[model samples]
Target: MTTSAMETAVEVEQRYGFDLIDLETVRYGLIEIAREMNDTLTRGSFSPLARDIRDCTSAVHMRTENGWEMLASHEGCVQHAFTSPHIVNFTMSEWDESTLREGDVILVNDPWRGAIHFSDLNVLQPIFVDGRLEFVLHSTSHVADLGGPIPGGFANGAQTTFEEQLKIPPTLLYAGGVAVRPVFNHLLENNRTPNLLLGDVRALAGSLSVGASRLNSLFERYGLGHVRASGEYAMDLAEAAMRRGIATVPDGDYVITDSLDEDAIVAEEITLQMTLKVRGDSMEIDYSGSSRQPAGNVGTAWIESTRAIIGTKFILDPASPVNSGTLRPIEALLPPGSIVCVLPPSSCSSHTETGSRVVNMMTQALSEAMGARGIACDTGTSGVAVIGGVDERPGHEGSPWGSFAVPGGGWGGTWTSDGVSACIVSIAANCRSAVNEHVERESPLVIWEHELMPDSAGAGMHRGGAGAIFTIGAVSTTVITITGDRSRSGAPGSSGGGRGMPFYGWLLRGDGSGSTLDPRRAIGAEPLFGVFDENGEPDPDKGTFGLGTTYMGGKVSQLVLQPGDGIRLIVGGGGGWGDPLERDTERVLTDIDDGLVSESFAHAAYGVVLDASGAVDEDATAMRRRDLARLRDQNKWSVPTACPPAWNTATIMEVAS
Candidate 1:
């Protein structure tokens, strides 16, 4: 802060009879408190999305005159940073500070009311001092299952929200310092995996208690008023810092348009457009021209996911603390009834499929504005694959088990380094992939292989990251759902670069011979209701007769398999950054030796040929590079008709139960 601004802040502190220096220390203390809550939740949760995917967030907030303002948050997911405060805003009218009790906790998961989706439930506690409310602690986590036909909450195809699952408003899960038994029991009775999810709820409540305890200690030591003001000061600093960053960028209206691979509900494409207006020290993202509510579970009514996408654009660092100030300057024009902001009663269970695509689309646009600071497109699919069956994995004879896996693809290249391989996309901040050993132990399946694909990364001066291929076999009858895209088109590159290879996979027979089954007849794990005629139903007569076989890409419904049937999943690579022929010949040879790129592909894509001994043939390489450049100019190497990297993402999903 400037000297004059500091004096003004001091004057405000004096007026309130609080010490500014004390408030500063209290700021750091609040941050530690949030961290404690995050650790508690991570260690205490049971579901893979929570423990493995890290699909959760924690924050402490102070309500201001305008609305709830974020004070400190867990330094984790970018999508969670600026969106937590908005969650409080969504429930403000329903319940205010005066209405909350000292020990009462409220729960909400309705997507229209500040949640990412129906699967993610949030637990909130109002912090009080001397019988007066001062701060509120909020925690959110993605649970594996809710009461429904599907194992997880992602019902890929359903006409209305009623079919999605249970929809709880901002109601008190706890009343007057006691756990509400009726609410708890109701949830348990509704879900298939009650034992696993109950533990998740308890963990969320535990995190709230932990955060409250640590925050109370800070208030007891520094006085609640001073601590609150310190939070205010911290937000002020964050807003100022963000303004400075905005001022550094050139002011202009930067617009970019893109689309998803296909709507899993039907054979249609979905579009997402972003027009960023950078003013003196502010930004406005206008999604005015995007596609409206199409028929499917592809889009959602949740704005939290949109805000998270905007938040990721502002702060690239994964560990930065995101308060309300980080999003204070951006004005969004998300037209109601649009894909991201769908109307209520539309199934948004798997909204992340399309929401993640928005994150990639915006990132591509930002990279054009600021080359050094921006990143390229991502393997935009959530890569959702659901496998479920009776537990035959030893010791458990007939218990049913279901597993959800989002096999991550390669990341797009950036100015600083090559895109990362087999990592979660930008929106899934700090999420961990499921381990092969764990998958084997939990379900009746064996993870055969998990290795990076060769010649997968987009060829460039600095290549994009390589994706991976995984194969799994069922020990018994298993059902599979494939919600994927990019089978035909791959992650597109930029700056005269080329796209990476698209996804490819198949279902193989048990005998280890040539494949014997074809999944072409499958309606997908989660097929849009055969109700195109308003029948709203699945027709077994037309559905797959249990042929769980190979699928190149696109959505497929419940593909069934006999014992020994297995799947081979290949994830796509990230988009390249620059011209492939411009890449260094030595790097190309080194990539070959490391098994990242094939020698044939290296020579074909990068004009870098090797001699008989496998070293770079400089003279021949120079000639080849010139010839490649000439061909590129002639549109021979250009993807004149190829989809843009941000376009045609496999944002589609199919639910298999």
Candidate 2:
């Protein structure tokens, strides 16, 4: 190159350095800001998901030619942020820079315009340096009631997106450096929990301001040019790290397939298939043969699934930087209208419930292709939250209000160890249910019992994690809504591991009346019913199916508990690892004493002979394992069909058992 051009290039790099650091600093700063913003909403608002469950995300982005580059804070959520580029392009085309003044903001909850769902409100503010757009600060949070046909806005049977709730596109809610009262008033007037919605919106807007302020400060310290350069540097580092990580896996072609129980809304079973081709240091994920997206179904996009699996791997190995560069060697082929590439205007409310199943299927397929190397299926699914309304204080105005709660589920078992019990897994790992004490304080409900269910995990050489049980009572007459999945079936096991228990929910009455609640059903009623539990031996006496239970009302009072009204919740367990016969006898004995694994299960599943004192018969256990191994080898089933030619004993055991 010419001397002048070379000099210019060097200057550009130095200037971009400050911009890069500023970008990254602002990215992390947004996370802390988001937490504080959420805290303010929880303390100031009335929504159960916001104040109690905490389902929200906040982020910042740097403007790029295609759109905004997701700079930081994809941790709070995975769905919306992945589609942020689309949102940015649409917004800029629709609104001019002159329209976005300092203190001005834009608001949208339109799924078509790049939102996960209507319940999640996305707020964006333009950050300017010297009156030119430099970055965008954004936040998204789940509002309990959005003036929907259903109190919680999760209308399961709604045929159209409009029936689900309102759709707000990129409207200039606040302009000319002022709060737009008309827009705020319209939102409040349309919702049951006006105060709560307003509070959440404010919280979202506040987070954006915080991010903008942090960006401005960074700009002053290092200059915008250097900040931009740092982003490029970070991307380069991330790419290098990801390439190195991919090199660890053996180079070859591996394919895996998984399916959904049924598209609840569509009432049809769907398949999600994936093929991973790793050649040297490069990898490509092909989703060509996946099922097509049904009309009006929104859960078919493969990008989210691709990001989720890749993101999970990145999380497991943080030494790998997260950026498009890390994804450079990775390519995805999602057919149009496939489950992974749903057409616009499709119902995607069930995306999380079904998307999780897709992730498991991919993991399962990968495990199969890789011969179970560096992978394991997590608890099949993250349990759903059941929420509704309750009536207390007969003489009081607005005596009825909404409430909700989520139950935990089992983690997946691994080749080396059992799954962790009652832990949320995969993409939704950070989500948590409401604390019992807090639930009682905020709503007219009483928590009866919240404990781990015994022996619910799959039994094998490495046992899975245990599920949970929670019972609650309504202080007064109330109504509630329920939404979630993984109740009908549990996650599948690997090798010789057993399947984790399925999840369930039911309703119990004071008069000894009870009924089964469909996992896909969303209903409203006084004295609502809810349950969150994994599958296990059924109880004929109480008529408990072992999934979950929730009750809305049994009495009438003002946020006070009365006798005879309650709800029950149960979480599921993870799958086990290896054949039970291969489990250590001493380990089985210790499990029996610790109440993790029952003596009967130890004896039956693992072939461990335990005496009355909980001591193991080592000779018998050894003989049983030897016999089992011999049988496996004799049948030519001791190794996986896809095992490499250089496979070893451990590899054989992992693939076979």
TM-score of each: 0.87, 0.80
User: In each prediction, how many residue pairs overlap at the backbone (N, C-alpha, C within less than 3 A)?
Assistant: 16, 61
lDDT of 1 by residue, 15-101 (tens): 545666666678788888898998899889887767667778899988787678888888445466556776777876578556678
**Backbone clashes (count) for model 2:** 61
Off by over 4 Å in 2: 1-48, 78-86, 265-268, 279-282, 294-307, 310-316, 319-329, 394-397, 512-567, 624-657
CA RMSD (A), model 1:
7.1
lDDT of 1 at 407: 71
Best by TM-score: 1
Candidate 1: 10-residue stretch with minimal lDDT:
530-539
For each candidate, the alpha-carbon lDDT, in order, equals 0.69, 0.56
94-177 in candidate 2: lDDT tens per residue? Answer: 877776778788988775566666777878888887888877776777786777666656555554565667778788877855
Alpha-carbon error at 476 in model 1, in Å? 3.3
